[model samples]
Target: MADTEEMFLRAKHRTFSGLTEGSCPSTRSCGATAERLAERLAERLTEWLTEWLAEQQAERLTERLGERQAEQLTEWLAERLAEWLAERLAEWLTERLAERLAEWLTERLAEPLRDPEEAERQWTGPFCFIQAADPQLGLMKAWRIGDAVGGGDEWEEEVALTKQAVAGVNQLRPRPRFMVLCGDLVHAMPGTEFREAQERDLKEALSGTDPSIPLVFVSGNHDLDQVPTPSTVEQYCRAWGDDYFSFWVGGVLCLVLNSQLYFNGSACPQQKEAQEAWLEAQLSRASSAEPKPKHILVFQHIPLYVKSPDEQDEYFNLPQEARQSLMERFKRAGVTAVFSGHYHRNAGGCQDGLDMVVTSAIGCQLGDDTHGVRLVAVTADAVVHRYFSLEQLGQRGVNEELRKMLQAC
Candidate 1:
């Protein structure tokens, strides 16, 4: 165990130093490094596991198995060890790189206004809103990854976390004027029993929140089919009401878009055209409205980009062509900020004067991040935001319950 730990630490240091010396410029480069590191770690783990197995067999199991059988068993165990180590190392590296990318963006986006007038011009309303995304209620059960660890029923953890989040929102001293769930409310495919259960769990959780606080929903790839169809769209709408719509919350023009259309290969032409026309009209209206909205905030499921607006397309972000076009529109319309939540982690970056905030999930955590929601305060001169993890909000009990459940499983 000590040898394996030393090997991993050395490998991690070498990888990080190599990337730093090479001046790897983007998160994508870090991703490449992570891949290399995973491979290296897997090899080291395989070697360590093989040695340990051989030692055990020689010490006690020699009489139970023949030489050939022991060798085969050792080989099999080494193979599984390599695979598991690779996966775990990749996950760890991805989380580390994500944190670094977020830090880099914070430094890049920190602008100090020299002129008082310039600072005053960005003043927003006094109210605030909460942005939560990807509750993904039944995802744990559907994925079945937890089943192997005796945690097949781990979906309850998601429900508990969500419920805690809703309760936390209600308990805020100055309650948020509204809360926007930026899509993937449920994880099961459309029409699945798991999907229906997810919907029920989510609705029940939200119903416990303060009734005065409005809730807005957006469509995500998970909520609908992987590639949304007309029927899937209809089903989502029937359950959550208009997938795309606009509303006002304390002088803010909040436009909720159906991001599924942006990538849905199965979507009809009319669906695309209608959303485009509607978006243009809404932006135009906001641009010309009397006492023009203090800020234009866009909410969607997927972000335009993760680290930089020019970054290549990834599963976490919008497609390149659509991303560029929509960013142009957002720039033209003076959209202050855009919040999205499909990545299941918190990352933000500013491009062309618009801030893209991709919030962490409120249900299950994908990366090394904790389950939480972003509380954004739109003040007189700036938009301030912070993520509140469940533990920070007096919801550590949920974590305790989850630990017990997983232990029992």
Candidate 2:
């Protein structure tokens, strides 16, 4: 019993000893040692926690201040730059206005609009209007070729030919008061690389020509981009100015239509109807007026007929009904002629007393040939057309291929 009691005490002491060590008894050295150790741990924890919290707070404050400073700096910089730009713009505008005003004042005092010339210049009796078309200015190979003879292309050769044409037109003694271009003023779109080339060529071609000569343009399908967009048309129209408008030169009432209408699908039928109505109105007015227009001349890009071997392949040839309606209307109005292009070859067919004159393409020809335009001499007495090949006008030879094409034609 004594041994058992002693063993039980020993077991109790072993468990209780571990508990006492964990809690630290008050009278033991272990309790004092534990208290010192706890005090040191508390000091170290407090020091570490205090330092960490201070650093976290400082970093947050610094970041907040930096963001605020950045925003303020950006605002200040924007305001300053805006103010500077505004002031500079205002000053520049003011300077320009003042300069323009000075020029206006000078012009008012010095050079007023000139009065009309009453002096009779020798009246070289009124000449007929020339129906010119498709001066495809930017065509890389605007030349002609022969049918039988295989020859080289002469794109560069025709540049001089074009200049010669312009010079010939200018030197016509008494130039045609008005000229018509059936279209394709530029090779491609109005504002494309082709257009830039065209602008340069035109500038050179018309350099020494008379400014009084009036030019009329009929918008060809190629005049704008292949896509039918208003902006492209507007650009061409604006670039050409009043030249793109319709007006009478003498007794001939002329109308130039935008031929791209044919490519506009169902929209085109409506547009065609509207144009026909407009034409009827114009013809009616011209017919009824005193000193009525002796002739009604219509210029457009695509010809109504090509009389090709494969008639179905003709590009944008006028529909039978539309052509018939136009012819009938013009016949009734006593219209004399219609000038057009887009066949790339000359074709003429007269029906119901009106003459249809289709001009040759000024661009490259499909058949080996020389490309050229027509010179029409119309008077009260008669309308005579003479096809003027550039070679004859310039007294020079065209590309052998183009020459062959011309002969084939």
Candidate 3:
């Protein structure tokens, strides 16, 4: 019985030891050395944890980086688009406005006041016109002070005279067709003091004239600057109509010249050349026109000659070379008369079928002639003219002889 019990106990011991050896425990009671077993378990746990953490963190980091990049790119594009739109809009508006203004100014200068296609060139009948000059507004005061170049501050005396002249023109029996003031509209030079005021007062005085009579303005030395540039000439045109223009009344072709151009063209040679070309065309065309003018006349502020065609050059007359050339041109063109008034007195003569009429001033005179205007009669036969003082013309009218001549047409 002892030997059988010993065999069973040995069997039980072997079975139990096999079970403990095969089992793995996480505690220090394991069969292997405790330190080595613990080290191997810790190494396996650390490897698993590191691999799991890497998967989760890498996914989140990729998602966050992608979202931030998209947001920043969207913001950058939006800001660039807004800046470009603002810059383009301003450039477009400024360019369009400048083009429109230039077109308007060009149209206004070409047409001026008259319409030739509307038959203003047609002949109605024989008529008479009044020619006058130098209603120089501030001249009286300037002459009194012995300094006409400086101009005067006051113009009351000349203003009164201009009003009287207008009143006299209104009192005529058969009213004059038009009144031409041959130049020196004011004593003040351009850019001088009292220029605007003098022009204003003179215009106010002449406004009293009858509306039937149009006023023809001629530019004088005072109206043009002493040495005229392109800028000065443009300024003069703006103030007193065109510096030079032509018109017709009762089949008479009247050519008004800017004599200042011929006098001094050093500053504006182009302007001088243009006027010469225009005058040449005008004279050549009028000489052989289809309808034909009753008589061709020339009006200007400065005379080709003050007294005689062959006279020498002076302040009051055109240069001798210009005078001869113009006289030859006028004779060729059948121009019957040339009227002017910078001499401040009546001093001109007729030579070789051309009548040079230099009418006196209506303002301060530099000579012995009284302040007056000229009455010009146009007929199928001949052109006739007579100078009369303001008092004589206003009170007496044209005498019966002159009245008969005007009605003869």
Candidate 4:
């Protein structure tokens, strides 16, 4: 027993050491590899270009100028042309690659909830929708081993949990009008190992969802960069859907926000500004339009404040300044409840009339809360919601409560 314990400790030490001393992390190496490849392409392209220019223009240049002058002009032109070509080629390649990957994600995920125009946005009656977050397809095991990063080489647990959640929602007696995954669709960051596989597997697990229930998505910090860039946002839009959007269900206006912008828009100010403008426009129109919405609900990845609007800023909640401004706007605009998921635990409170409801994760738990999802039932008077473990989601009691809520419409 003593010998076995010693061997296990040594093996664990080696694993930790290997990560620190390992070759370049996949995220960094991916960027470096693209840069180097572009450099080589530019070098080869320069050679080919110079030869072509020299051959094609040599006779004409000699006829017009001295041989020496013509030769110098040709060299100058080749250098300038090569530099321009390289810049354009590199830019094109990055955009194209991100686009193709996004296409791949969309092809598998099959989410069609982006277009608000194609769907119903009118006040109907009362209904229910599932609001869950942080399926984070690879975080369960990683968190267990205390190596959240670089330890997500496998994500079977997340896969099972996601499927379980899907099945739970599907079995509801009164099916949810739609389901929104608040963010962190996968634990693997945008450019790390197992990211693609996790995304693909997640999509496959979600594919079993009933066609009648549309799947809505919100962008999480893990979904893009903690401080996202234009490139990452664009990539996210391509792979998922619009980072922010609006839709109406049973007369309620639902806004899916990209909280990453409000979190850290330093890298992408223009995007942040654009979202702000769009949001104001959305709020203004929704509040004043004919037959005003039954209620305005917001969906985002990070809660405005886990407990109170005056709470100190932390990693789990939005910064105080942004939070105050946005929350006030939401309150003025008649936003009822702001649904979010990032704390990996349930925390939030009603501020004045606004409710900042934070749901626990469906994949991993950072605290005592069991893995679960939030069910939100919308009525003409209020937006009622509850959290239930996956096992409890389909229970008769839960179903009866949901039925009662919808019947109140």
Give lDDT tens digits, candidate 2, residues 197-315.
Answer: 66555545544444444445567766765445656665765555421234544445566766565444243455446665666688898678666665667787777666631245345
> How well does each candidate superpose onto the true structure, as a TM-score?
0.64, 0.57, 0.70, 0.70
Best by TM-score: 4
Preferred candidate (TM-score higher): 1 or 2: 1
Off by over 4 Å in 2: 1-126, 142-159, 190-192, 242-244, 263-277, 308-313, 395-409
lDDT of 4 by residue, 185-251 (tens): 9888887778788877887787777655667778899888798999888877766767887766666
Candidate numbers sorted by lDDT from highest down: 4, 3, 1, 2
Which of the numbered candidates is closest to the native, going by highest lDDT? 4
Clashing pairs in 4: 123-251
Per-residue C-alpha lDDT of model 3 across residues 1-409, encoded as one tens digit per residue: 3433332222221221221122233222222233344444444544454455544554565577675664555445445543443344334433443334334433443232123322335566667889999998898998899887875878898998899899988887677867888988998988888888897778778777765566777888888876678887886776666776677666678887888887777898999899889889999999788678778898888899987787878888888887888899999999999999888999899989999999999998889988888988888778888888888877774655457776664
lDDT value for candidate 2? 0.54
- Model 4 weakest lDDT span, ten residues long: 11-20
Give the per-residue lDDT digits (tens) of candidate 1, residues 1-409.
Answer: 3432332222221121221122223445544555565555555665676567557755454467877777677667656755775577556755665556545543443232222222223334376668899888866664557532223234687788888888888776555767788998887778765667767667776776665565677889877777888888888876776778776555567788988788764565688789999999999987887667788899999998888888888888889999999999999999989999998888879986899999999876778889998877775445667777876755545334322322331
How far residue 60's Cα lies from its native spot in candidate 3, in Å, is: 99
**What is the lDDT, from 0 to 100, of the residue 194 in candidate 4?**
82
Model 3 misplacement above 4 A: 1-118, 399-401, 407-409
